[model samples]
Target: MDTPILRNNFKSEEYQINMGPQHPATHGVLRLLLTIDGEIIKKVEPDLGYIHRSIEKMCERDSYQQIVHLTDRMDYLSSHINNEAVCLTVENALQLEVPERVKVIRTIIAELTRIASHTLWWGVMGMDVGALTTYFYGFRDRELINDIFEETCGARLTMNYNIPGGLMFDIHPNFVNRTKEFIAHFKTKLPEYDLLLSGNIIFQKRMQGIGILSKEDAISYGASGPVGRASGYSCDVRIHHPYSNYDNVKFNEILKTEGDTLARYQVRILEMWESLSIIEQLIDNIPEGDFFAKTNVVIKLPAGEYYQKVETARGELGVYINSTGTKNPYRMKFRSPGFSNLSLLNHIAVGGKIGDLVATMATLDLVIPDIDR
Candidate 1:
C-alpha cells in the first residue's frame, strides 16, 4: 500500500502555535505548544529542557561544600532560600544545631528573598498583561532588597549565603538599618501597587473569574506556594513542616477560595504583607551569637538518606541527598515547586483565552531553571 488518507470525523477550526522557548510571557525559556480556536485555548503542551544544567548530576561529583552553590542556579529568584534548603538538609543529617542568631538571620533573609522575587514577578506579570507602569514600580522596590542582599552576601541574585551548618558570613553592619528603611518605604508603596494594577478595571476584567483551578485539582497537581494557597489548598511547607524560625513567627498563610487568576494575584499580594510582618518582627531582635556554626572542612554524611524542605517564593523546595559515606552525595535530587505548578497549566489553560493563560502562569511565578533542573 502506498498510503492511506484517513478522514477526520470532525474538522476543527483550531490551530497550533508555539508560545516560547524564548517568549517573555512564558517566563524564562519555556516552550508552550498551544492549540487554539478563535483565541480560545484547547490544549497546552510545555516543551522544557532548553536550559537544563543537570544540577542533580553535578551534585554527585562536587564536594558537600561545593554543592551548595549549584542550588543557586535552579531558582535564582529564590537563590538564598535554595541555598538554605541544602544547608538545612546537611545540618539535619549531621545533627548540627545552628545558633539562634543564624536561624533568625536565615529566616529574615528568606523573607527578603520572597519579597524580591514577588516584586519582580509583579512587574513581569503586569507587563505580560499590558500594564507597563507596574514594571517600573516593581523593580524600583526590588532594587532596595537587592542592595541589602549585596551588602550582606556580596552578590545580588545568586547569593550562596547559606552554607551547610549556618551562614557563610555574618550580616553586614548596615544590613539591619537598610532593611528597616526598605520596609518603611515599601509599606507606603505597596498600596500603590494595588491602585496601579489591582484596582484597574481593565485588569480586573481580564483576570477575575478566568483560568479557574479548583482546590481538588490544585492538590492533585501537587501545586504549592501561592498557587495552591489561592486554590484553598493549605500546602504551605512553612506551616506544615516548620524549619528554622518559621515556627516562632506569627504570620497568616494567605488563602483564596476562588481559584482564579485574580485569586492567585491576591494571594501573592497578601503574602508580601505577611513577609513584611515577618521581617519587622525579627529585624531588630536578631540574637547575638556566632553566625556560622563549627563544621569540619571535610564533611561526609553517614551512609543514609536525608531530606529537608523550605518554603520558597514559588513554593516548597526539598533537597534530598543519598550519602554513601562520601564527601560527595551518592545521589542528589531537588523537588522544585515550579515543576508541579507548571503541570496544572494545560489543565487550567484549556477553554480560556491566551491572555488568561498568561495571567494564570504569572500567578504561578514559574522560574524555568527550577523545572529543568
Candidate 2:
C-alpha cells in the first residue's frame, strides 16, 4: 500500500476585536471595531455616536449667547477656543467690532487654552504609551493654567467665557502676573518633558516611521492643526486666516514633514513653545478699553449665512451659521477637526499592530465629544 498521504489544511483566519466604548487607550467613549489577522491590523472601523448630544440641533433652539455655552461641552479641552469660534461667527454676521482690549485678551487667553490642552494631551499620550510619569507631570503644569482660568472666567474646564459680542467679563486683576508666572514655570518644566519622554529610545522606536500619513493624504482627509502640519500641510488657521489680533503677533506655525507618529508628537511639543511666545507678546500689551462690544439684548443675524474658523488644540474648528433674521440660528453646524482627523485612522493604521494603533490614535489627540457633536 502506498504510504498514506499526509496533508495539513490548517489556515489562519481574520478575527474581529473591539478596542473600546470603555477602553482606557481609546481616551473616551469611542468604539473601534478592528479586523485583525493575529497581531496585524487588517482594518479599523470607528463606531461613533456613543457621546453624541445633537449639539447642532440644540443651537436652533437656543439664543446666540446660549449657544456659546453649549459649544464648551463639545471640545471641552479647547472650550475657550470653541467659544471664541462661535463668538467670531456671530460677530462677523452682525458686522461688529469688539474693543481692542477684548481682541488682545482673547488672543492671550486662547494661547493659554492651547497650552493647557496640549499639556493634558502630552500627559495622557505618554500614559497611553506606558509613560505613567508623564500623566502626573502634565496635569501638574496644566493646573496652573486652570487656576488662571478660574480667576478670570470662574470656571476651569468648561469655561463659557466668550459671548456673541466679546468676552463675558474682563480678565482678573492678577491675570497678567499669574500668566507670566505660568510661562516662567512651564519653560523650566517643558525641557524636562523632552528629557523624560521625547528622548526615550523605546519611544523613538515606537513612534518614528509609524503611521506615515503623506501630505497629499492629510489634505485629502481634511486634516488640520498639528496633524496636518506634521504632514507638511500649512493649515494653521491662526496664520492662514488671522483673527482676534493674531495678525498683529509674530510666531512660527510649527511644521514637520515626516508625517509619522513621532512627527505628530513633536509638532505639539513645539507648538507649546509657540503658544508661550504668543502669550508673552500680548500679555503685557493688553490695551486699555472695554472688554466687550455692546449688542442688542437678543442677537438676530441678517438673513444670510456666516462662517468662522479657529484653531483649537486638536485642530481647526469651523462654525457655520444659517440665519433667517431670528434670535436663534436657522441652522448651525460645526466642522470639528477631531471628526476629520479620525477619518484618516484606517488609512494609516492598516498593517500595524494593535499597540501601534494605540500610539497612532494618541497622536491624533481625538476628543470624542468633539467628533460626535
The global Cα lDDT (0 to 1) of model 1 is: 0.93
Q: 1-373, model 1: which lDDT tens digit per residue?
A: 2233334544558899999988888888999999999899999999999999999999999998899999999999999999999999999999999999999999999999999999999999999888899899999999999999999999999899999888988999999999999999999999999999999898988898888999999999999999999999998998899999999999998989999998999899989999999999999899999988899999999999999989999998989999999899999999999999999999998998887888888888999999998
- Candidate 2 local lDDT, 1-373, one digit each (tens): 3344332333578999999999999999999999999999999999999999999999999999999999999999999999999999999999999999988988999999999999999999999999999999999999999999999999999999998888898889999999999999999999999999999999999899989999999999999989999999999999999999999999999999999999999999999999999999998888998989899999999999999999999999999999999899999999999999999999999999999999999999999999998
Best by TM-score: 2
Q: What's the TM-score of every candidate structure?
A: 0.96, 0.98
- Residues forming the 10-long window of minimal summed lDDT in candidate 2: 1-10
lDDT: worst 10-residue window of model 1: 1-10
Task: Return the TM-score for candidate 1, rounded to 2 decimals.
Answer: 0.96
Q: Which runs of model 1 end up more than 4 angstroms from their true locations?
A: 1-12
In angstroms, give how far residue 20 of model 2 lies from its true place. 0.4
